[model samples]
Target: MDTIASLFSFITTPVSWIIVQFHKLYGAIFGPDTGWAWGLSIVSLVVVIRICLIPLFVKQIKSMRNMQALQPKMKAIQERYKNDRQRQSEEMMKLYKDTGTNPLSSCLPILAQSPFFFALYHVLSKIASGDTIGVLNQELVNSAREAHIFGAPIAAKFMDSEEKVAALSASLTDVRVVTAIMIVLMSASQFYTQRQLMQKNVDLTVKTPYMQQQKMLMYIFPLIFAVTGINFPVGVLVYWLTTNVWTMGQQMYVINQNPTPGSKAQDNYLQRLLKSVSSHGEVRGRRRRSVVQAIVAKGADRNDNERKFFAGLAKAGFAAQADGTVIKSDTVTADAEAGSAARRQQPKRQSKAQRQSGGTHQTGEAKPSLEKQQDTPPKPAGKSSPATPRQAKSGQRKGSQRPKHPSSKK
Candidate 1:
């Protein structure tokens, strides 16, 4: 731990300077030597660092989602080159390159924060050893050493000896209990954050190794924290716990607002959107409009949740347009009802009497006449009527032809 901290020694001065600045602000209200002053300083430092890492966090999210989407292609490449390790590596790189994905992007926030973490660790370690480092002069160091957070000195560790804890004006039992509770809280917070992410935000429809890896990390991360937490000072634990809570809250906001397309978060989001749009008869906000626009752009490719959303809109007599606006569509509903009514209507059946009479039923409706007299002039008394010239050329009669007796066929 010392070696690692030394590797980031250059950052210790800046980290200590920031903490001292925050301590000055908090110390005035909470007392310069109180736990709240020092503990909140650490927390403030974490907030400042995390806020600066927001861009990296966003890139991490994009990278993780992109990795999930590329799993099938990655799996295919692995299978095709199962026997060729070098070629498989090449193809994997090609896939990542073409997709503009960096597998390491997901680690950017952690990597970016590590220097500060180690620098803080080093500073606290020095305070524990009664040494002044960075901008923490002897007077500030002495005050920090005397700062007790919930009966435990800020620089005390769970593994600290009784003598060391006594020297810091705290009992061993008090220090151990405080540190234990903090460690447990930190680990639990970490676990819950990852679990929330896996359960609500991940796209479960795609079976991928990326999901498996995430699940593994869900368990692994908390365990790692719990194991390493014993070595962390009480102040470091506070820093980690505060950061974990911040991360959880940030993730919840993202999952609620702009979740993955096929995730449960999206389903819930769309349901809420459906209710809002149905109540107001329009999309309410620019963010919601963008969401609707994307879903509309998906068209037939939309998932079940999105399809249900569209159906709900239609049921409310609202139609979503390509530009993400909803409009009342009374004509669409009326046309649908009219078509259904037409399908349900059957033609009136003709009775045998009506068919035989070839005239109207008792109703007053008129039927067309099949013939007025025959177009021909009255034939001479004894002369047989010759076939019409048009009929002769056509080789058949036009209207109904009489059937000849079978035995008298020509």
Candidate 2:
């Protein structure tokens, strides 16, 4: 328990302290009596956290995109040494090294957030429940209990209370209701943020497996949030909703400014939104696939096959050499380096006859006796071959060149 408390202290020590300070400052500005002040503080905390996380979020997203981009290459590597497990493991790591994409990037931000969440839980539990939380002196605990956002007391919102739902009345189920609503908002924001990323914000160069993973997240997080939200205090839900909303707006800003090329956000999400609001309100597909398919169909009309293919490759850097060596490319192989390259320019296999013929024959040589034997007619049964006459006459030549077989040594 002491170890757990010490671990708890690490996250709560700074962030929760800052948050408690924010509540104080907000209450100071709004007057200490109003619950709206606490509301504003939660909102404020969300904004600050979002801003602080922006760089990390960018790093996470960039890592995911790179992972997506390298998927085909990874697959190609897998296929190449399918029969060789040890080599496959080696090559897979090499492929990851080459791409600088860690699959774990998709999870790092999540893991980093865990401590902050636990700390916030402890802090809010104390504030709402008046638990005194060991770290907070009695004065601080009393002040937190009195804290309000706007005119509503934070303690009244059920989020801060740290009590079970059964303790609250049917009349006060509103607290649970509010909690549920906030939970939905949290899940919904997470859902749409992910949806937009797949349907809009991704780099076109993103690989299929990565895209599939993103698609999986669209469903996964919502379910997770829905199940988990009921257990969290209402204050925590507010924080979650706040955090998610901040992400939503920040992501929208990024799509508008540095939108990924060949992504739906660049091509449609922003454009469609802008258009719907524009005098030229030309709304396109409600779904991203439709929008992309439409674009591909239209683009195909103007682009010749080779030009279009190269353009696609150029954008993806598929045909471009990353490692300073020129690629003789094949479309079938999944990896850029290891794919169907060998097949594309495979040297034709030599027949057994050609292999047996020691090296290529140069013109203008007299046939050797072995060559003559092959060509020679069979002598009548009683007679020795007259062609033996050549070897007999020039025994030294044949003997010096190749002895048919030496005696086997013991």
Candidate 3:
């Protein structure tokens, strides 16, 4: 630990300088030698560092999502070159390169913050040893040593001996108890952050090694923190705990706002969107508009959650447009439904006899009555009437009937 801290010695002066500045601001309210003064100084330092690392954290999130999306292609490459380890590695690197992804991007924030963490540890260790380092002169060092957080001196550790703890005007039991509680809180916060990420934000439809790796880390990270926390000074433990809590809150906000597609978070988000749009008759915010626009752009490619969102909108008598706006469509849908119903109606079924009779009843016209037909004049006898050509042809023999006619007359 000492060697690692020494490696970051270059940053100790700046870190101590920032801490002193924060201490000056806090020391006015809480005595100069109070735990609140030094403890909050460390916390302020963490906040500053984290604020600067926000860009890196965002990149890490993007990188992680990209990696998750590439799992299928990665798995195929692995299987294709399973017998050739070198070729498999080559292909994996090529894929990452082409995708503009860095596997190490997820570690960027941590790696960026490591120097300040170790530098603070070195600063606290120096105070515990009654030595002055960085901008922490002998006076500030003595003040820091006298600061006790929850009855444990700021520079004390869980593993510190009774004599060393007594040297800082604290009991071994107090230091151990405070550090143990802090370590547990730190580990729990870390575990919850990762667990929520895995449970609520991950694309559950895809089963990939990336998910398995994340699950492994979810357990592994907390265990690592629990093991290494004892060696951390009280002030360092406070730093870690504050940072863990900050990380948890930040992740919670991201999961709630812009969750991965096909995740539980997205489902919940879309449901809420459906309710809001139905109630307000519009997408309320720019962020929500962008979400709707992206979904609309996906068209048929939308995931289950997005499809359900569209269905809910239509059910509520709303239609989503290409511009991410909603409009009332109740009348249009109603007219379409009416037309379909009209088309679906069939004529009444007819019996075989009625169908064979030429279906005059289906024509919807009245037939003449029997009394009216009898009242009509019978023209055939009166006009015999002129034997029409058709009648003459019917009465005459087809051919050669003269001889037969003569015999009959005789």
Candidate 4:
């Protein structure tokens, strides 16, 4: 036990030094007397450690994706070697080696975090007893021992609640209550983050050994944390809770942007992208349809108006020929002498229903009708017409105005 303690102490020395440096930095900012400074220092230390482990977290994500990709082959190996356990293990190992994937890589982040967790636990526990460990002097340890996060000392534990209360001359109920709350938060955060990964990011259809292990851990790790959190110091709980929060946020980002191929998160991400694209396409299609409908309706209205104008002209004793030419009422009477020739030259006019319903006729007749109406000769200098009022006014202005010679300007 003594040899083990010495080895553990040696392993935890760097963690102690880091905490000491952070405590000094936070103490300078928040004042040495404030207990929350040391508590914040512990949290900052956790941030630094998690930041350093980002590459490992990325590796873990890649490994998980690789594992999901390999699920089919792993299942095949298992089915082929159901009666040969040794052979199955060998095949699985060979598969992992060939794929350059480590079944344990997903656990690397957690495994790496464990020693730091224990080290922080050790440092906090030793400092609480006023021990000079690593770079932490007696003064700093005393200040750390006195540190409180929400009235619970950084070194306080649920298991040692009574001892802490008595030692600080504080209320036993307050310490216990604070300690219980921290444990609950620590355990719950860890549980929630781990459960989120298992439920969302993992593909559940494959029954490989790795997937089975994940399934077991989905329940086991949380249970372990819930049971073990009672004995953890408040500072250690702070570190864990902070780390779990970081993990949850990081995992959520990964699940959204780079989900595992066969996972629910990936499916959801794909569905969202496809939905957005389809919705945009539908909107553009509707817009195009609406534009076409409006243009067709406008053209129909214009055709109807032109037909009414020409019919009015025919009723008032003028005639429009199929060649899009209009003959005056006086000329129509003169042309009556060649009625047989006129009838032979004129094309048959279809009924109003046919003219209105025939899209091609309406489109073909519109431009020609407009051109003939524009080319119609001015009225025989007698009556004013409502449609040509602007032209009549312009003609009167032209008759009244005379240009002066440039010599008059001098």
Candidate 5:
């Protein structure tokens, strides 16, 4: 027993030293007589330890996610090798190894912190028994002896009592009450964290062994804490309670920001994001409609094509605006119109005679001929001439002669 105690004391020395240093620091700030300072020092120790274990926490999350992802394949393997336990175990281990994930990695953070918990537990236990152990000097020992949280000693246990009956009864009562409260709080925090993961963050569709294990642990951890809390020193209880709170908050943050896929929390987050985007789009659409209305009210005579385009935008939940146009641009439309106008302005092809005479007619502008107009002598009443001066100038002859008047018929 002595050898074991010595080994425990040696292992706990560093943890006790850190706690004492923090206690001193808090004592300086809040004054030496404040019991809450020492209590807070234990909490600070938990914070320091948990902070150092962040990498393990990350690994745990990654391993759990990998396990969740591999659930289907794992189920298939189990189904195929139901009669062959040895082969099934080998296959499962092979799968885990190939994926670079250890099924036990999820327990690493808690397992790593167990030694520190035991160290603090041993240090506080020695102080409660009035012995200065390990790195706890006489000053820290005196402070530990004096520290009381709500009249309950920091190193006190629920079953510990003084020699005198009156003192024993009061001390036991105080210790029991405080321990009960701390146990409930610590157990509740742990339970709540697990509940959140199962209810909000875990995929219900997956009935894998890992998820089942998590559910089982949910009940087991709280029961364990409730059962064991009475034996823990007040300072150790404080450390555990604070760590529980930290874990709950961390789980909440993960559930809110990066919830497990196909989970209730993920669905809720996606729904919220979609609603926000849709609301923003509606507001922008309204603004665009107002702008388009303003442009139309200003009597901008938009062409049929422009009107059709704006109507299409409206139909597609988009709106046109003077500043924020939502359709094919006015510049492009203007360029097309300008091209059509240029085509209309081009001159038409001239006739062969006009080309030979070098008398081209510009578009919508005709030039007069250089030849003078001549009147033929009035035809005799009985004349039947077949050619006219115009036809003669063109070197052409009429095929039929004009008929004589009826008076010349005889």
Candidate 6:
């Protein structure tokens, strides 16, 4: 009975079965010593999984856009009922109801991938630990154990996670450089994958506070992957790194063909990062100068002022683009307008909805005469005051002034 159950379990374990096939495939295709196959297999698997997650990723992006769109109305509700928590809750609910957006939709893809990520980790760990005999058939185990993919033991640094390596591995062999490179690439690529997804695929509208929150999460999430990448297996690292490269390519295709409103199709993080890295500290300084110049350019030809200001920076070899503003591209238009001296001098324009709401609340739109005030007569300027004892003593005059009534409007 135990043997039968074990056979059924063995048949179901995809990783174990795949590991068996990998050994045979490598042996048959490229001979016994050509060990690059394992890495390629891992990369292929990662790509397959990422492709499968595409729908989820698309859904996440759509939901996130909806969330961003709802943010302005939610903020208005928050402000309108700032002191009344109950009404604020009601208003918030109404806003969400109208917008059909949920704040949590942003995390759907990540949540869906959690189990697969853990499963992959476990599968890779098992193979790398040299305990494949039970997980895979004996023939497959023997063949796999002899395999040296990338000149390192397939199972060499499975749980090591660190490049420093264990004393046991050092006594047996040295693959620190390979393991370290793998780990770094894995971490860096994961960072790039997440960063690109957010900066490209996500239809993030920054007009709302919710979108800013998403932006903060984007950086925070990448930072997390960079920190946690150290703990994943090197094979897992390769998987991650490859998956990221795939995502970058996939997202690039999507963005290039159908870019988001605020995104630039012609440029990418690689260009910016490479420029920043190559220029030492000069890129950032130039960026600040260019922004200041662009702002100045909107009003005056501050070229002379900029020259004196940025003369010390000429040695840095990075200068503000001469026509980045003057030439006018979509990227530069918003920056030139808002960051400009002209915009600072000009008052902001109010929206039509705001004007209508303000008029309804405070203008003559709701004007009506007060019936009570209209009905009450003022004391005659030349007549004696009614409350005086002398005037009261003239009872006929006081009695005559007090009697009047009308039918209720209700």
Highest lDDT among the candidates is held by which one? 3
TM-scores, in order shown?
0.83, 0.57, 0.82, 0.64, 0.65, 0.51
Instruction: Supply candidate 1's per-residue lDDT for 131.
Output: 97
Stretches of candidate 2 exceeding 4 Å from the true structure: 1-6, 78-91, 146-171, 203-207, 268-410
Candidate 2, residues 1-410, lDDT tens digits: the string is 12343477666767656666776787678865455555666677767766776678889878866765566676787677889989987887887787677766766656666666667667766565566664566666666566533223344444334254323221245665676677788999999987777766765343444566777878998899898776676666777788777767877887765555455555444344333323322333444334333444454442232244334443333332322222334552346545457668876676675556544334424345565567666568987864354453543643324435567553
lDDT (10s digit) by residue, model 1, range 36-131: 999999999999999999999999999988986787798888788889999988898899899998877856877898899999999999999999
Cα deviation of 122, candidate 2, in Å: 0.5
- Residues 310-360, candidate 5: write the lDDT tens digits: 444443445444554344345655666688899999877777877765655
Question: Residue-wise lDDT of candidate 6 within 1-410, one digit each (tens)?
Answer: 22323434433366445544564565567764345666656655665567788898788667755664465576677777889999988877777777777777767766765555555566554455545534565445444445554555555553354443442233223445566677666556656665765666544443444656666776676567666665565555666667657756766666654434234432342244334533564334454345445534654443233344333233333334454322213444444556676767875565787575553433336434454447766778899775644445633654235434666452
State the lDDT of candidate 3 residue by residue for 249-306, as single tens digits. 9899989998878889999999999999988989999889899989999988888899
Model 1, residue 223: distance off in Å is 0.9
TM-score attained by model 1: 0.83
Model 3 regions lying over 4 Å from their true place = 75-90, 335-410
Ranking by lDDT: 3, 1, 5, 4, 2, 6
Pairs in clash, predicted candidate 5: none
For 1-410, candidate 4 gives per-residue lDDT tens digits of: 12333456766778888877877788889887576688888788889998999999989988988988789899999999999999999999999999999988978888888778877777877766778887888887777777777777777777775766567545567667887787777667767777778888887777899888877776776677778778777788888888878888888888886666557776675455334433443212443334223323454443332344334443444554443333456665455547758788896677787676453463355333554667677676777765543433633653233557988974
Better of 4 and 6 by lDDT: 4
lDDT of 4 at 361: 61
Point out where model 6 deviates above 4 Å: 1-12, 18-27, 32-34, 78-94, 133-135, 158-174, 194-209, 262-410
Q: What is the lDDT of residue 157 in candidate 5?
A: 75
